[model samples]
Each structure stands twice: as C-alpha cells, then as structure tokens.
Target: MDVTPLSLARVHFLASLGFFALFLAIALALAWVLLLFKIQARRTGAPGWTAAYRLWVRLFALAFVLALAACVPLLFQLGALWPILMERVGNVLGPLLGFAVVTVFVLKSCFLGVMLFGQRRVSDLAHTLSVGMVAAGLLLATFWLAAMVSWTHAPAGAVLVDGRYVLLDWVEAVFNPAMPWLFASLVLASALTGAFLLVGVSAWQALQRPPADAERMAFRVGLRLAGVALALQVAAATGAAQWIAQAQPAKAAAAAGYWHGGETARWVLFGWPDAAGQRNRAEMALGRLPDWWLGRSAEGGQLGLDAYSGMLPPVAATFWSFRIMVLAGLAMIVLAGLTLLRLHRRRLDPAGLPRAWLHGLSAGTWLGGLALLAGWGYMELGRQPYAVYATVTVTEAAGDIPAGLLAGSLAAHLALYGLLFAAFVRMTYHAARYGVVPVRKAGARP
Candidate 1:
C-alpha cells in the first residue's frame, strides 16, 4: 500500500490509540495498588501501609504524567493533518477544531508541570490541591479529545453561509450523533481493568509464603468489584453493538458475519477478518444460524437499518467485535463472581482459591485486552475504504510518507514499548514480593 502523510497520520493515530490503552492500563493498575494499600492500612491499622499508599499514589500520578506526555505528540501529528481534515470538512468547523486542540495542549502542559514539581512543596494541603488540579486537567483533556473524535464522525453546531463558517449549533455539534455507548464502553473498560488489577495483585499477595489476611480480604473485595465492573462492561458492549447496528449497519453486519439474503450468517468464534473479501471467514465454519440467536435481525429484513447513514459499517466487523467484547466481559464477571462467592463462604484457601482466582483474573485481563483491541480494530478497519472522514477515500489521503520510514518507526516503537513493559512487570513483581513495610527511624516521619 502507498503511504502518504495522511496515511502516516492515520498510522500514528492508531499507534497513539494503542499507547493510550496501555498507559490507561498502567495507570489503572497503579491506582488499584494505591487504593488497595490505603484500604489495607485502614483495615489493618498499619501506619506503614499509609506511607506505601502515598508512595504508590505518587507513582500513579507519575504514570498519568507519562501518559499525557505520550499523547502530546499525537496532538501535534493530528494538527499537521488538520489541513486535510479541514478540506474534507469544507473548512466550516476549523475554528472549533482549533480551539479544542489548543485547549487540550494547554491543559496537558499545565498538568505536566504541576505533576512534575508540585510535590516538592512540603505542605500536605498544597500537594493535595495540586494533585486534584492535575486530575481535573486530565479530565478536561480527555473531554477535548473525545469531542474531536465525536465531531469528525458527526459534525454539528456549525453552518456554512455563502462560503463563510458560522457557529450556530455548538451544543448540537458537541453532542452530535449521541455516542453514549462508545463513551460508556471506554469508561467501563477502564473500571474493569482497574478491578482486574486489584484482584490479580491481591491474589498474588495472598500466594506469598505466609498468607496475608489483609491480602486475602483485598482479593475478595477486588473480585466482587471486578465482577460488578465486568457486568457493566457487558451491558455497555451490548448497548454499543445496538447503537452500531442502528447507526452503521454494514460494519455491524461485518462484525456479525451477516450479509444480504436469507442465508443467515453465523458468528465466527475466532478468526482474522478478511478485509478484501469483506468477511470474517471462520477457521471452522459453524454453518448458518438464525438472526435471533445472534441478537441481530431476529425478524430479518435489513433489520430496517440504513447502512450508509453511519460513518462505519453496520454489519460484520462491528457485530463480531461486540460479540467478542461481550463474551470476554461475561467470562470475567462469571469468574470474578465465583471467586467472590467462594471467599464469602470462607472456602477460599490460600493454595486453592487464591491461586485459582489469580489465574482466572489473569485470563480475564488478557481477554479484556483482546476484546478492547478487537473493538478498536472494528472501529478503524470497518471505517476503511474511506481514510479521511467518510467522504475522503483512502487513496486520496495517501500523501508523501515513505514505506521504510513508517515501518522503521513502528518497529522502534514496538521494541521500546516492549522493553518498558517488561521493566514495569519486573518493578511490579518486586514491589509486591520484597517491598514490605520498612521500619522508620526514631523521630522520623512515620
């Protein structure tokens, strides 16, 4: 495939999305650890745990800083491609887009500064306030990014009058197309990831030489919370699927392996999507199945869907991604629920329940990761054929990027990120295993 600046931008955008997910995962994991430490301190009356909790909180804050930094370059990259995007959008929404971009950069920089230096001040109240500010800034940054994404697919709140742009429907544009399901899916995934980390860490703690009761309790509570989060994830995925079916029929059908005619396509259990063929040919065909069983077109007849209405396809890709997300979500919920149940019954022995629960949580974490990736793949790939907005064809967007540069950059990023990931794992393991509470010297701050 030929590479253009636009194609490069698209590749970078996808890479940023991957980095965003990984960073979010790391942040969630850190947050979970911090919360667990705080809870343990409160429950066990351990003053040392308070210090540990604070340290972890600082670490979590640092991760957020790193995440923001990692995302900043993407904004610049997007800005470079803004000219193309503006041309595609007919230049009407340019100012709004510019405003959003500027606001995000400013907010990100402010937060980064605060996170980097605010802790140096010894005042507890000042430190707390600074942290809160950072959090609020991050939220604003997220909103700005989300608004940009939402606007691209569904432009609203603006009008073109005789060649000039007029901002008439700001509110409409802000909430255009109503992407509640997509937003909910992202938030739910974050929560589920956090809960899964909590459970996994607690279980690992419980498996240490002498079983820690605090760790066991944490594990149980984490399991319960994870179950709840997973249930919410399932519901969110279902809603998202329904939304796609209503808004983007072709993508949804692709995801569900559904195509025209009464042949009744069956969902693939596992297989790579054949983009050229416009189908997800299963490694092992399950044969034609009823639409009702697939929770789509049970009554048949296009389900009265207008596939062209949405920017994405309403069929195959969207449908399959939703199913994958739901299945993984449900599995997590079930496993977590069972772990919670066993704990409640006092049958969660260290050797049996804790180890089993850890394994289950790990599986759920990996599955959730896969589901998230698949969902994103569906969103991007299903929107293919048109690379820049739905109106701009992929061929048109391909600009001046060399194949070698793109390939080399991707390889470098993968290697660097892989090393960082391994280091993170090692740090986490060491912290969990050998970093127990240390004794404070006399007259020192406890």
Candidate 2:
C-alpha cells in the first residue's frame, strides 16, 4: 500500500475540508438558533423565550470562534496541498473569498461581539438586529463557499489563457452551473443542523430530574423547527439530485450504481465499484428511480460507466457517500413526520412530549451532520483524479507537493481540532445546564 504524493495531498486536503465543514456547520447552526430565538421572543413575549435567547447567544459566540480558527488552517492547506489550484486561479478566486471575509469575518464577527459584550449598551431591539445580521452573514458565507466549491466541480467562468487559468467572467465563475443547486441544499442543511442541535440539547434538558417547563418549551421549539426545515429539505434535495444527474452524469452513474448500459438504470443501495470492469461487483439494485426521479425518462441519459471515455473519479467513494447521504435524509424525514404528527394531534403540549420521543431525537441528533458530510463527500470525491474538473489532474497540478510536511500538518490539525471539539462540547454542556444569562436592568435606557 504505497501512498504517493498525490494520495498524501488528497488525504490532507480532505481532512482539512472535513474539519472545516464540521466547525462551519456548528457556527451556522448557532446563528440560526439566535434568529429562531428572536422570532420566538417576538411572538410569545415569554420569559422562557428570553432565557433561550440569552443561552443561545453564549453558544453562538463560542461556535463562531472555533469555526474561524479551524478555517485558518484550510487556507494554508490550499497552498500546501493544492498549490496548483491557488497558483492557477488564485487571482480569480481571491476576490470571491474577499467577499466572505468582509461579510462573514468582519460583519458577522463585529455584530457577534456587540451581542455578547454590548448587552447593556444596546437596546433589546438593537440586540435582536445584531443576531439577525449574524444569521445573514452566515448565509452569505455559505453561499460564497458553495459557489466557489461548485465551480471546481463544474467550472464555468474562467478560461486557460497562455499557461495560466484566467478569469473571463466573474458572473459565470460566481454563478457556476452547480452553484445554485448546491447553495439551496446547503441552506436547508444549515437549518437542519441547527434543529438537530436544538433537539438534542433541549431534549436532554427536558429529561432532567423534575424537568423545568422552560426546558419543555425549548424541546417543542426544537421539534417544530426540525419539521419545518425537513419539509423544505425535500424540495432542495430534489433540485440538487437533478443538477448532479444532468451536470455530472458520471458522478450520478457512480452514485446510482448504474454501471451497466441501459435506458432504465437500477439504483443500488451498496456495492463494490469495479472501475476496470465498468460495473458494480455486487449490487442491491432498485430499478428506475434515478431515471424517473430526475425526469430523465426511460432513456437514462447515458448513466453507464461506459458512456464516458476520459479519466473518471473513483466510483466507490462517490457511490457510498451518496448512499449514506440518502439514508440520512430518509431518517430525517421520518423524524420530521413524527414530530408534525404529534403537533397536529395536540400531543405536543406544555405538559411535555413523551420521554421516548425526546430520547429518539437526542439519539438521532447526529443525522444532520452525517447527511451534510456525506453529501459533501459525494460532491467533492465524485470530481476526483482532478483538482479542477477537466482542467487539472491531481498528478499534473501537485507542483512538488511535500508528502512529509502534509502528513505532519495533518497530524497537528487532528490534535488541535480534537482539543477544540472537546472544549466546545464541554462549554456547550455547561451553558445548556446552567440555562440562560440573567436579564440585567431591563428598564435601563443605557
């Protein structure tokens, strides 16, 4: 099992991406929670909502800090592991990234501090506006990242000029073919991630000995939030799936396990992708769904591996990531449906929903993260063997990549991120347990 420099670069790059995604999801989730808290306070005027608002403000600040810290390394990885990407198109992407730095790093970070430190200095209305702005910044950041990554998968805005890739149209680069679909999916995913965190934490709070009523309110809010988000996720998932099917058919073929040539391709739950054979070694096939679902009809739009001639990305990674993402999605839909049913039946009252239901949500809290990670892996891995689709192969663009340095960097990152994760979990647990900041000097104008 010899690991080449290419493999080392890939592993380190993937690790960096995974670590960054986790923290980013946390930050986005916390931002959404703040916004939800603001809306809840406006609607109910309840002390419970106020307490929830204060509690979430503390958690969001912690998440924002960790996410920013994790991102710093990823910027380094781009140059260290994928120098080709930076050298070739740095100019084109530099401005796009600048937008996120300003919107998210500067604007979001400033407002976040105002919310955390300026509590007494700012009015309640001003505090709410601050949190809302933070949420907006998160959304903008998500969009910018998604669009940039989507461009790598299916580049649209640049051309190879002389020996370098040059930016021809900023519009085309920013609004790549895969950008809108990916952006839609990620937006729903952020909400889903937030809902799950709320459900997990609030459910734990509700199960405390003697279970406070405010905790019960938070639990109900969590479930309802998840339900509403799940409904929207269905629409988003559909668009994303269709976009993948059409824009990247080779990836879609791998995903659906449709290796054999046919108009009606069978969907596989799991299998070994035999790239050399151009087929799945062992498959559990569910027929025609990918074709019909994508509105491709009987003619499956050349889903077989044989359809493509050039270098194809690894099939197994694409296949399994897609499978895992879809399974996670199904699990979320079930949870959401059950939540909605309870609401409609009037069973979700202040007396507190069943212990079993709370426990169920707590148990499944990681599903949103699983779905998001798997979907990201599917999207990214399916474009592999190339740093940029059709333009740069991993080998061609590596640019004297240092295997030893990458391995060292990967180890250091894992250690640092592990510490960060432990700290975050501990901080959040204490925050949830203690429950909410005190509403200080409510009548003061200053």
Candidate 3:
C-alpha cells in the first residue's frame, strides 16, 4: 500500500489527538471525582475518604501532566501539517483556542497547587474550594475546545467569503447548534470513562489483596456513577445521532450504512458497508423502532451515499466505528447493572464478588477510553475530505511536505506515545497495589 504525505499527516495528527483525548478524558472525569472525594472526606472526616482522595489525586496529576504533554503536538501540527487550514479559519478558531488556553493556565496555575499540595497547609474549606475551582476550570476549558470543534463541523455564526471564514455573530458561533451536543457527549463520555476507571482499579486492588475501606468506597461509587452516566450517555447519544442525521445526512447515512434513504423507519443495527456496491452486506436492522425513537430525517433525501459522490466519507470505517462504540457502551451498562444487582443481594462483599465478574470489571479499565476513541473516529471519519466541514477540502488544506518526512514523524510519535502509555500503566499499578503512604513530620522514622 502506498501512503501520501496527506495521509501520513492525518495519521500523525490523529495519534496525537487520540493520546490527548484518552488522558483528557481521565483528567476531566477525575476532576469531578476528586471533588466528590474531598467533599466526602470533609463531611465524614473518615480516613478512608481522605485516603481515597489522596490516592486518586496522584493519578489525576499524572493524567493532567500527560494530557498537557500530549496536547503540545496537536497545537504544532496545525501549523506543521495543515497551515492552510489555519489561514482559512484562523479568525474563527483563534479566540476559542485562546480562551481555552487561558482558562487552563489560570485555573490550574492558581488552584491546582492548592488542590495537590496545599491540603495540609490550608484549611479544609480552602482546600475544598481549590478542588472545586480546578473542576470548574476543566469544564470551562472543555466548553471552549468543544465549541471550536463544533464550529468546524457546523460552521455557524460565520460566513465563508474569499476562501476564509468571517465571524458574523460571536454568540451563535460560540454556542453553535453542534456545540451543545458535542459538549454534552464529551462531558458524559469523560465521566463514564472516569467512573469505569474507578471501578476497574478498585476491583483490581480488591482482587490482589483484602479490600480496604477506600477500595470498597471507590467500587460502590464507581458502580453507581457508571450506571447513571451510561443511561444519560445513551439518551444523549441518541439525540446527538438524530441531530447529526438532520444536520449532515450524508455522514449519518454513511455511519448507519443507510444505502437508500427515504421515508423509511428501518435502522441498520449492524452491517458491512460496501461503498462500491452502495449497499450493506449481511445487514441486521430494526424495521420500525428506530424511526419511532429517532424519527425519520426527511431532509436526508431519498438517495444515501449515492447523493454525496466524491464527498462521502469512508463507509466501512464509519459504520464499524459506530457499531464498536455502541457495543462497548451496551456492554458497560450490562456489566454495571449486573454488578449492582449482585451487590444489592448482599451475597458477597466487594472482594468476594465472583472472580470472573471481578476479572471482567478489572479488564474494563480501558473499555471506556477505547469506546470514546471509537466514538470520535465515527464522528471525525464521517466528516472526512473536509478540513472545515463543507467549506474546505482536506487536500486543499494539507501542507506541502514530503511523504517520507511525515511518515517518519508519525513513527516517532507512535513510539513515544507507546512508551508514555506503558509508563502510566506501570505507575498506576504500583500506586494502587501498595496504596498511599502518609506524610510524616520532620525527622519522623518510617
């Protein structure tokens, strides 16, 4: 297979994005979890709660560091691989990116230290306030970033003139129609990912040794959070899907493997999308329920990918990515439900739950992260051939660079990310296995 510079650049950017996304999801989700832990610690004055807060705060720090590190490449890649894109949408994207950066720097610089190390130096109220601030900052920063991405897809509040985007309405541009759905999806996905991280880590710790109070608390909290978030995510995803179908029917059709679009209620649950044939091989579908639930998008028109010739996204990639994401989400919900049921029955303690079940929960450590990645792939791949949705073609925006150089950089990035990920896993394992060690006074003996 031959690869062009554009393809290499795309893959390199995607690798950077994927790493940043995984860590960012962890940081976003854990920020709230850390706040909850601190609140519980303050309310109950329990050592277990404090211990949980202490232990998880370290993990949060690691995730934040990696997230920040991973983001650096993406920023540079915009100029390095797609300078034309910046030239085109710079006016619209500049403010959003600036706000997100400022939010992170201000919030993290001011309160992150307090949340991390000043807990002992400051009053309980002050420390709790710091944690809350950090969480709020992460959410705010995410909003700006999500807004930037959504604008690229929907291009609202802006008009394209002379090959450039000119902002008309800041408010509409900031809160574009796609922005809210994207924000909601991202936030919920992060929360769900964090919830499962808690569940998986706690379960692993329990299996390795006698369950501690902190471990039990983490397990129960994770289970409940996962259950609630999963349900909310399902609803949000359904609504988001409908929105996408209405807004970008071609994308929706490719993702769902819809070949012939008409006034039909049939929903393809699974299929192999054959782009050449313009049909789904071995299709499985719900005849009427999907249309009832999601509504038939009349705007989608009678033709599917056929109508979007020369502009349609890769069909199989979109179709399979969507299915993978759905499968992972459903699996998570089932696991959470069953685990909660078992706990409610009081047949076994957190550690005493069936070994198979515990193993399954433990194995789910990366499931949320992977599922979120798939969801991203489905969304992004569906918007293929466009650097700024319909306005700019990716080929037009791609930078002039040798294929060899791009390929070399891609390889280097993959290696570096792999090493970083391995380090994170190893460090996390040691931290969870041994537990947090309390700080002692000066000259105190171990």
The models' CA-based lDDT, in order, is: 0.56, 0.74, 0.84
* Candidate 2, superposed: residue stretches over 4 Å from native: 292-301, 347-352, 436-439, 442-446
> Model 1, stretches more than 4 Å misplaced?
1-12, 28-52, 79-83, 86-137, 159-167, 211-221, 271-300, 303-327, 347-356, 362-367, 387-389, 392-395, 436-446
Off by over 4 Å in 3: 262-270, 282-289, 292-302, 345-349, 440-446
Decide which is better by lDDT, 2 or 3: 3
**Superior by TM-score: candidate 1 or candidate 2:** 2
Q: 1 or 3, which is superior by lDDT? A: 3
Q: How close is candidate 1 to the true structure, as a TM-score?
A: 0.75
RMSD of candidate 1 to the truth, in angstroms, is 5.2
Total clashing pairs in model 3: 0
Candidate 3, residues 25-100, lDDT tens digits: the string is 9999999998998899888988888888878899999999999888789999988899999989999999899999
Candidate rank order under lDDT: 3, 2, 1
Each model's Cα RMSD: 5.2, 3.0, 2.4
Whose TM-score is greatest here? 3
Q: Give the C-alpha miss distance for residue 204 in model 2, angstroms.
A: 1.5
Model 3 lDDT at residue 132: 95
TM-score, every prediction: 0.75, 0.91, 0.94
TM-score of 2: 0.91
- Candidate 2 residue-wise lDDT, 1-446, digit = tens: 67677777776777678767866776787777777777778778877777777787777778778778777878887776667777777766778788877787676558878777876788778888888888878878888888778887777878887646788898989888888888878777767776777777776666664456556666667677778778888887787778777766677777776665655666666789887777777667775564533323255455566666566777888888888988988998897677767666665542346888878877777788788888778888887767778777777767585667767767887788778878887887788787665867657565
